[model samples]
Target: MPRTALAPDLSPGEATAPRVQGWCPGALRPMMSGDGLVMRLRPRLARFTREQILGICDAAMRHAAGLIDLTSRANLQVRGVAQADWPALIDIFGGLGLLDEDTGLESRRNLLVAPDWVAGDDTERIATELLARLDELPDLPAKVGFAIDAGAAPRLLDDSADFRIERGAHGGLILRADGRVAGVPLAAGAEVDALIALVRWFADGGGKVSGRMARHPAPLPAWAMGDVAPGPSAGALRSGVHALGVVCALPFGQVRAEDLAQAVRSSGALALRATPWRRVLLEGAAPDAAPRLAPGWPDMDVADLAGWRVEACAGAPFCSQASVETRPLAYRLLELAQQGRLGAQRGAAPAGADTRTVHVSGCAKGCAHPAAAAVCLTGRAGAFDLAFDARPGEPPQTADLGMDAVLARLGVN
Candidate 1:
């Protein structure tokens, strides 16, 4: 796809307005947190070329905190940027062809693509078409998003989105509203039109609710549910992959810029695709080449269950809204979970058991994993609030327990 021409009016001042809460930050309109500006970059297709990756890392090191966050949405965020450096950073992104020509177009381009999509595949075609027509989309809420899961097996069911386009049982494309089980089938090459119609319908009050399509109770248009197979199991890909290139995870979805840069350089991979599950699909690396590219960056082959189970947000000093530091505690919690120490006693089983998912949020917002987890630890005034099989804001089993007390209670030494 050719790059859209840069809009003359584009400037740092024209970035999305700041919100105290509930909204995501973008490159143009970054959110101010305790640890400097939180600037998010939404790649066109959840992809980054090796050069692009190195450029981003360099930018982060010079203009931001040198930390690159692979968001659950499969986007990359350059966190901890200074106010004065925002313009320079934006210019750097523009030079890298990362920024959209129009600010509104950029914010509305909330898309998640299956990382395994190959060239000229259904996923790549449909995603590229939808992005080209972003101007036609209705004025939906900032967070209302779309997903293109055209892989033989769906891969983004866990990822949040207002609408989803996936392959139906018959191998035809289906445009499904987020909450609805059924979807209207699209004729060959009609995916973009149907998707636009659905968005327009929603904007015209077809769905009265403002957030995700699932949250709205409005009935879906006449469409039949196809016998679509369930999505593939969620986790890092098996080490010896057959079709797609090697897939691996960055521990806790955190990676140092230099480490990532070195990995990309050593792997000899042309590009990297970020997945919603916090794993990165190296485009051309073979099974043996993956580890050499990013050594010490935990791979699924070692402690697969523990690496995929735990998630934590940038809390405390990094985020102004957080009451305590979360990542460190999350690491400790994951270590205990892996050892089965923080198990049934904490109202949850071990990592590989039924309770395989864990979320440690610095605050009630649950920025890391918005969905309910098998075990949830939310910070409250430097103490932790415990919730089981529930999202934040729901009633908790205990509140305001210090880290040590909570650990002891969970039987973690």
Candidate 2:
């Protein structure tokens, strides 16, 4: 179904603005630490060598917050930082060539390389050079983004990237945006500059496109979705149970700092990738690897077994606009689900086929998803919308139910 912004109590005109920035009257709450200037430490990296990612996880747990967010783009952010420590963190990342603050171009610093590009001969070098140049570009668009992918093997190539740099007919990197190839030709070094220019140009002409890398149904592009991705910018193909597993979030994407820190400390010799999917990818635990440090691994497939889907913004306790605690509702749903009130997979459902996803919103501002879900629960007007996502432009299937009644619909009451 296509996305249409909705705010329960709004007048018709207010429907167009996003619930977060657009409708939430006080969305710009300060996220400052003691020193105050906001925690704005931007890092740069063409690729994460096995060693680098592990070291980063270690440092993140030690210096900043233990939580890492894998953005829709193949990038990571460590939150819970103290403002006074910003400069030092910047220096640490800068020394590793991981942090950059070239304001004019740095804000637009995200780029995803195909995972195959990870093992390719020239891919890493190309990625490194391209990134360095991105930081040096004349201008940066707060909205522009890019990707580099090629003959795909995994589900990741389908990831939506504004500028997808692919192999041109001449063996050069081609720049694509909003799904269309740029009209201009670019040499390898000029690729980064051209990308920056295109993003700035597009941002100037269009409405805000998030730095996220997924496709939104709102806008349509002239170009065909192509086959090529900057490697699986975030996941992998290592063989072993521990080699690859997702860090499952408890329903509405919240994990206690203590639990997260313990996991970080206990990891024996693995690298973690924070995923927008509300989990972490633990690498290096394959068969030939060292033993895991934790008592048990997180059953990454539990949600599928439980046959329930749920997502939410860091509302209430975290965000000021939240009138209700979305995570709590999400967990309650999970509990009812485990008892068989809701459906669970009879056997493991093949990946990507999980039919149910429960989205709980603090207010009407649905920050977690661009469109309505199979079930949309909001705190604002005190209602829940049972949707089918089966139709094109229908306001989600109308079911005005209370929290418990909504739970029972999924057989979870």
Q: Choose the strongest candidate by lDDT.
A: 1
Question: Which residue ranges in model 1 land beyond 4 Å of their true spot?
Answer: 1-20, 206-209, 223-242, 292-309, 313-329, 345-410
Please, what's the RMSD in Å of model 2?
10.3
lDDT (tens digit, per residue) of candidate 2 on 201-314: 444544354433234333323333333322223343332343243233333444444444455445443455433344444443343333322223343333343666656655
Predictions in order: lDDT = 0.72, 0.45
What is the alpha-carbon lDDT for the whole of candidate 2?
A: 0.45
Can you write out model 1's per-residue Cα lDDT over 119-213, one digit (the tens) per residue?
89899999999988999987776688899988776777777888888876666677878776656777879888888888887878745356667
Clash count of each predicted structure = 0, 19
After superposition, which runs of candidate 2 have C-alpha atoms over 4 Å from their true positions?
Answer: 1-43, 46-68, 77-98, 115-122, 135-140, 150-156, 167-174, 181-255, 274-279, 286-298, 301-309, 315-325, 331-357, 362-374, 378-406, 409-411
Q: Note each model's CA RMSD in angstroms.
A: 6.1, 10.3
Minimum summed lDDT over a 10-residue window in model 2 is located at 21-30
